[model samples]
Target: MSDDPTGPPVSERTALRADCASCFGLCCVALTLTASADFAINKDAGTPCPNLAEDFRCGIHTRLRREGFSGCTVYDCFGAGQKVSQETYAGQDWRTSPDIARQMFRVFPVMRQLHELLWYLTEALTLPAAVSLHAELRASLDATERLTRLPAEDLAELDVSEHRDRVAALLLRAGELERAGVARRGKRSRRGADLIGARLTGADLRGAELRGAYLIAADLRGADLRRAELIGADFRDADLSDADLTGALFLTQAQLNAAKGNAATKLPDSLTRPSHWSADRLPTA
Candidate 1:
């Protein structure tokens, strides 16, 4: 993990490491890849990263920035990589046991995704503005943790996308509940918009125009938005953890922030704290 856990703690540096020194390069050997932004060569699932040296370190580690391997730089393991390498498989290298290595390799990605969700959900729960969604947050958190603890075979076969879709439904519902009873009036123009599942966390959107718009499950964490104009707009389960909006033009704090605000949540320049609010306001959702 990075020395500084502040800021958006979702970067690769914040992820856990597998301590490649003690184990074989199971991740590289078991996983396959095609030429993409993170890699330069086409490789199959069981192939190792070409940059992986025999010593289990990245061959291009010193020059990864210049070698078009920036993707590798951003990947975090959340400690699962090492867990798999040491605890689960007992430090067995892919070279020593290709079959087990393959299983580990396949499971690594699944665990990584779960960890990423945990990171986001945990961070989300820290926002005071999202108190209204506390039930939903806790539920999601439990679900995410369950997935993280799934058996390797089960995780490998899990349909993560389908799970994401299901969770999204709950988030959308939370958004609706939070924005209930707010009057929306304006020249509606955000019809048929595709803001669904967009990560607009902590965006500065004060006094813009968004009528009849679709913002379902948007990650509006820590956004600097205060009353611009929002009539007939959808904020289904959008995360607004630590957004600031003291004098937002038309938004109602009860309707907007009430849905999902945390203690770390920042408020607008002139708004007072909500009565049912918590002390841990998130920065912005």
Candidate 2:
């Protein structure tokens, strides 16, 4: 983490960590679910998940995956749940005041999006190669943070796309500078490439730029992705069981959560191993 007083932009250590204790099961109530393989049953929006407890805990928390609530395991509000419950709603849960339920559900997602931007902005500021753009990044971060604290009505009407576009442009420049600073020139850039299920085991991809690549279910076991620019790569179901991603750039927890990985997968320091990856499913030494 960058040791920034406002907290590391992307590290969900405390500020952005999911403080479930302070939340009122917003994820369960606000998010609609379909009876896909990931979920056991279809659920409507604004209705609480059947497994939710009165105290806002998942009744089947320990057995969520086996119990057909696998989708819940990968969801991360990035502390937006707690922020809405504690900060925005001021400790008033939707259950106690049913009238505010609709507004609270609407505000939760907006806060989550704003928090996602904060993560990206924070990461950009830490890149030394992007120093020239630091002033603008900081300003954007400050402005974005201010927006997260707005009233629910204003948040609902927020132009998130505009803010996202602004942040994305700044990040693109930052990525370019970082890539240029690297000693190895002419690195591979498979940006927006469709490499679905391609057998790329043990491929040498150091300093690769794979921004927005479609890598779904690709067999990338033991591939080296150190310092790779994965800005918007689709890693869902990607076989990264033994991949080296220690210095991978622009990778987020939400992205990792969606992907398939095991214990041997080397990840960035700021992120943690997903709970869904069991020891039996990991790559053998």
Candidate 3:
């Protein structure tokens, strides 16, 4: 077993992860998709993807990428889809009533943001360096959890960004405390840095502050990213064939799913190797 102290109890953690079987395909209908490397067709907000089946399952789920719906595979709603479909709406679906559907769609995104914050706050609470902030983190997590249970109308009208901004500030302080020892060595902060397509193969990035870095298409093969603050980092198409990310902070499954990796890439115990990642191209670690 791993020694990473950066996750909630198994049940709570499972709730934070997506449960598509309990969802009503909210992501397919509530969000928009544009034609690009990620998607093969254009879809408007509130419009359901043509691939969504009558029972709220994807028609090409097992072959989304092969069918030009690669974007679908990377999206994670942090369990908001099921929360909206089952808890908030009490199992009501859009297909039966246009009004309920509209409200559900509007509330889906709001719930997603709240859930994302909960995920981060929960992780922060688990960090030993952030022990001083545990009380506040717990409070924030509770408040965010309550928001997720609000009625559909209230959720639709919620100013989720405001809450997100507040949580982001708290998370920043916690991250700073966790990375303080490394920061003393003059390691530069790379928050929101635009390093798109930059070559960083075999780089040592331990304890680096790379929050929100645009590492899209960056060559990061064999890089060391342990304890790196990677919240909001864009890793689209970045290579991670043999990268060690055992302790990467605030790294989400969606981010990993969007990037390229192989069997040799070491990941935190909290995260799983993405199914799309190359399983046989490299030897296992």
Candidate 4:
């Protein structure tokens, strides 16, 4: 259990993280893959990737990046895959029961979206500054959890975007309140900015609103990004070497995987350092 009064127990957060062993490789088959810098081949939704084994494990799990499927490495189902495969379908494999394949695939994305919201809501409850909204956040978390356990048919038909909008509003308010204490006048509100490849090395972006910002390939080495709102911020190829991201809002493991960071990149307690990063390597002059 968390010692902090405002924080949730560790189990609550762990329940929302992906457990691939309990999943049926839903992401390997159900989602579409476009041939880009991320994926090696173009695959339509519902078609199994050639690398998916009968046991639902990736054939090239260790060599995904080398095999040109780097995008697969960054995609997280947020525990939705296992929930759908194990609980929703009662541990049924799509290979054995092909009849449910289409519906199961349809429901996976919706459940993923819900789980993502649960992730953010869970984090929001941990923020001391968002204490006033904690009651509402808990309610939202409970309601969203109930939705995740709905029948497969109902899940496939769920209007997750509308629910997301409502949740987003509450999260927005929580972020504002949390940032208000640490954010300087000019550091707040960079929500959805086009900062792709911009030079921001050693920058002080504390408590900045960086939601949905195109920070692809941005130079963010040694930046002070503590308490910044990083939801949906593109970190693809962005250099986060030595960047302090402790307490950064809504920063996911997937985003860290997409970015270029070394061992010196400080992360939030909820997230881990991506294994692909160099071990304690320093930035070049």
Using lDDT, give the best candidate's number: 4
Give the TM-scores of the predictions, in the order they appear.
Answer: 0.53, 0.90, 0.93, 0.96
User: Clashes in model 2: which pairs?
Assistant: none
Candidate achieving the largest TM-score? 4
Off by over 4 Å in 2: 1-13, 183-188, 278-285
Q: lDDT tens digits, residues 87-185, model 1?
A: 556667676676776677777777666654554444444334445665566677678777766766787787788776666555444334333333444
> Comparing 1 and 2 by TM-score, which wins?
2
Cα lDDT tens digits for candidate 3, 113-230: 9888888887887788887777777778888898998888899999987888899999999998888755435479999999999888888888899999999999888888988899
**For model 2, what is the C-alpha lDDT against the true structure?**
0.82
Off by over 4 Å in 4: 1-11, 183-185
Candidates 1 and 3: which is better by TM-score?
A: 3
Q: Rank the candidates by lDDT, best first.
A: 4, 3, 2, 1
lDDT of each: 0.56, 0.82, 0.87, 0.90
lDDT of 3: 0.87
lDDT-superior candidate, 2 or 3: 3
Q: Candidate 2 residues 25-128, lDDT tens each?
A: 99999988999867999988889999999999999999988898777887788888998999998999999999999999989988998887777777877777
